[model samples]
Target: MLVRLVYASRASRELSPQDLQDILRRSRDHNPAEGITGLLWYNDGVFIQVLEGGRDPVNARYKRIVMDNRHDAPILLTYQEISERRYAGWSMGQVNLHRLNPGLLLKYGETQKLDPYRMSGAMLTALFDELVSSGAIECA
Candidate 1:
């Protein structure tokens, strides 16, 4: 069985692309070891991420994320068990909203901006799925 956990958090300080890249690098290195896959979307100092894996590893990772000093005020948006992984093989996919075409986000009920905090967990996930399907976001 697979479990998916989604959360949104505010960066503790100004974030640079290098910081995000480092995070993704570490994640890509460690997640595959634990059989985890997910997507990370960053926009305007906010982070929305999903982690999918075994219940134990995913929960442990989420706990670590909540305590990570890079970001704070983590809010749980969704957590559920699924029959299969939606992001298999992608240890960590990234969506940098800062550079994405605004038109892509507008297709998901978002305005010209990518403010995911205002979206419900369901809506947010739906948007993520759409982005993935559209090939607007890619994992390294």
Candidate 2:
């Protein structure tokens, strides 16, 4: 069975641009073989990501993420069986939230900033769909 898992976590330490790129690079290299695909968003020292794949792989990946020292307080936002992949075109895609319009953020969130901790899984998933439609996601 296929599953989609969404989670949010705060970086354990301050991260630089290179640090983010490294994470993306490693994911891109590692996910395809595992049949994983997802979108990742990072801003204000927090990360919001969606992982889609077979049940076992997805669950194993989530466990590793939870144990990774780079992340602190990782919270599982959503997990469910899915009929299809919403983001299958990329092994791992990145969203630059800094460039998004404030009005867009306010539409789904209480403020002009994205606080995945405060948003519902459904809302965050909707926002991610909008991001894909708006061409805000970058892929290797």
Report the number of the highest-lDDT candidate: 2
Residue-level lDDT tens digits of model 1 in 1-140: 68988899999998888988899999999999999999998878889998999999999999898889988888998899999988885899998454466776686655876666676777778878877886766776
Off by over 4 Å in 2: none
The list of candidate 1 runs beyond 4 A from truth reads 96-101, 107-110
In model 1, the worst 10-residue window by lDDT is 96-105
Per-model TM-score, in order, reads: 0.90, 0.97
Candidate 2 weakest ten by summed lDDT: 96-105
**Candidate 2 TM-score, true structure as reference:** 0.97
lDDT against the true structure, each candidate: 0.84, 0.93
How well is each residue in 104-139 modelled by candidate 2, as lDDT tens digits?
Answer: 789999998789999988898999998899888989
